[model samples]
Structure formats: structure tokens, C-alpha cells
Target: MTGLSPDARAWLEQHGFIPTDDAVWLEALTHGSFNGSGPADAADYQRLEFLGDRVLGLSVAAWLFRAGDAPEGKLSQRLNALVSGTTCARIARSIGLPEHIRLGKQARDDGGADSDKILGDVMEALIGACFIEHGFDTAQGLIYRLWAKELEGDVGKAKHPKSALQEWAAGNRRAPPVYTVTDRSGPDHAARFTVEVSVRNVGNAEATASSKGEAERLAAKAFLERFG
Candidate 1:
């Protein structure tokens, strides 16, 4: 049970991915919570998550470069939108990553499997494993395939949800959006933040992410979805 489940294997197969090191992939799907009482050496996804972040960045950058002749600023915006924790969590949820995630009892009880922070981190860690065990080409292939729809058209058209949320509040004559950090977890190198965004007399929403800023943005997006 410490390894991949049958559903995970089938999911990988459906995506045409055959991992060379099951251990690495398993580690990629693990959360630090899973190691709370285990051996000190028990590996989790943190290190892999670090590497995967860079890999995904590089892959997306390259795609942006070849995709069009937009200026660096436009490409940067598109890149940020594409690789944001929001996008990662969406992809993770789409690929059924939550069910495969390994978490401690407390984390599982806290809904860590479906958490944006955990899902996004594990998604990057999986990419890192792919890059290490296979190569950049393999990782790029995976990225390209999964992100085709996002890469299809003008990805630069979307406004950042934070700005949009604030604008919505102003337009509706509600109080400005207020963000509050509800919780933080993980080590200093990779902190996970949970933020709540509220607009008085309007609505409130919460989200979790790798950084406070990202968490705030996600919370804003959730708020928009609920009552923008």
C-alpha cells in the first residue's frame, strides 16, 4: 500500500507514461505528513517538488517561446497563469491525483488529498520524477500533452483573479477584498498557506497554496466562482 495503487497504474497507462522508478513516483505522490511517525529517512515529495517546479517552468517557457512572437511581458503573464498553483491543482484533480496521494491520518482527515497545496506540490514532484527517471523530453511530452488545451489560444487574455476580484468588489460598491491567513504548514523552505478572502456584504472563500500570495489569489478565484 506504500506503493502505487491499481488506479494509479491505470491512470499512468492511460496517459502513456511508464515510470522507470516506481519508488520515485511513489515518493512524488507522498506528503510530509505521511512521514510524521515513520523512519527519519522516509522520503516525501519535497525535494522532488523543488526540482519539478523548475522543470515545469522550463517546459512552459520553451513552449511560450515557440508558440508565438509575443513580447517577454506577455509570455511571462501567460507562463504565470499556466504554472500557477491553481492550474497545477486543477490538473492534479483532473488526473485523479488526489486518490493516489499519501497522507497521514490527520492530514487525510483535514482533506489534504484534495488540498490545493498538497495537490499542486505532488503534481510538481511527479514532474520532477519524470525528468529524473526519464529525461526532459519525456517531461516535456507530458507537460505538452496535459497542457495542450491551455496552450492552444491566447492565454494572455485572462486577467489575474486577484485584480478581477478587487474590481468586482469596487464595481458592486462592496468593501474591498480582505485576505487573512488562516493557517500555515510545512517547512520554511516550502511553506503551505491557507488564506480566506472576504468582501463584506458579498461573500467569502478560502484556498490553500504554496505561498501566501498564491493562496490569496486562489481564495479570490473561489470567491468569484461563488459570488463574484
Candidate 2:
């Protein structure tokens, strides 16, 4: 079997993760859909995904342990958000990891390469590969490198906006913010909502999105950015 390409090796090196077994790295990049037409022994990323999930959790837990004076509950909540499927998918996209996956013809035809589930699984597989190749410290370092920006942002946005805004208003001896639906339209498959958020003593901001939840989040973010 051919060893890992120089470009792949360089990519790992640049990320400070070195793989001792290039085969494992290759396997981690392989999707099950690809094995049928090519190499019979080529394993998929499933097993690696399992291992990577644990590795990611442990690394994030260790980071929270060292970096915070917050209570366990708060840390756990933030950790949950950070490790969510959406967050994982976002991180996967940020690293351009989806571009390196080897998928089968069927998978390629179906656009599985860009599927969030596949990308998330591949991310875990990469973590698993890193752990097996470079050990804990290297894997932890790599996770932190990939997710540090997300982690930092999460810390600031940790409090669910409505609650945070309430606390801010109460602390300042002002009234709480109110959310009003300004516009609601769109088809059943893809509805849109627009919400206006006004603080009792502060100003007002509007956010529009595909879902009420998203619209609320955007409105809250806007309110915080404008007033808080």
C-alpha cells in the first residue's frame, strides 16, 4: 500500500499532530462507501469516530478544568453546547476536513461528502487518528487548536441571552427586555420569523431568521451588542 501523501503528512505536521501509522490516517479518511469498489480491507471511519468522540470530550473537560473558576454546572452546560452536533460540524467545515475524505461513488453522487453527519464523523475520526498516532497531549493540543475560537466565544455567550439580558437589566435596576414578533412569513418547508427586542431602559434591535429560535437568538445577540 502506498504511504500517506507528502501533502497529507505536511497538513498533519502543520497542525502539530504526527501520525506514526500512515495507514490508520488513510483509513480514517476513508468512508465505508468507498471500500466496495477499491481496496477490500480498507476500513471506514466508524470505529475511529467512536474513539474520537471520547477523546474530544476528555480534552474539552480537561480544558474546562484548568481554565475556569466557574461552578461545575455552568462548565457542563457550556461543554454541552460546545460539543453539540452543530458545533462539531462547524469546526469540521472550518478545518476544511471534508475536502480530504475519500468517499464511494454512491456517496459522492448523493453529496455525502458535504453531509453534516459525515463531516462530523470524519472530524471524530481525525481526532481518533491523532490520539492513536501522537498520544493524549498531542490530541488535546490539536482539539484545542481546532476549537479554541469556538470555546472562547461560547464562554462569553454562555448565558442564554434572555436570561443574561434579564440579569443585566435587574443588576442595573432597569426593566427586562421584551421580544415582539414583527413579521412571520414563508412556506411551510422554510418559514421565516422576524423579531424585535426592546429593553426597558435601553434601545431596540431586530433580527430575522428561518426559525423563531434562531430569530430570538439573533435578536438577543443584537440587543447585547447594541445595549449590553
Best by lDDT: 1
lDDT of 2 by residue, 1-228 (tens): 467778777876666667778888988888888787668888888999999999998888788878878788788877776765557777888866776787877777666666656777788888999889878888888899899898777543467776677787788888777889999875432356899988765789899865576578789888888888
Position 185, candidate 1: lDDT = 86
Scored by Cα lDDT, where does model 1 land? 0.84
Clashing pairs in 2: none
The list of candidate 2 runs beyond 4 A from truth reads: 159-228
Tens digits of per-residue lDDT, candidate 1, 154-200, equal: 55458778989989998998899999999998754356899999998
Q: Tell me the lDDT of model 1 at 190.
A: 50
lDDT of all predictions, in order shown?
Answer: 0.84, 0.78
User: Given candidate 1, what's the lDDT at residue 55?
Assistant: 94
TM-score of 1: 0.74
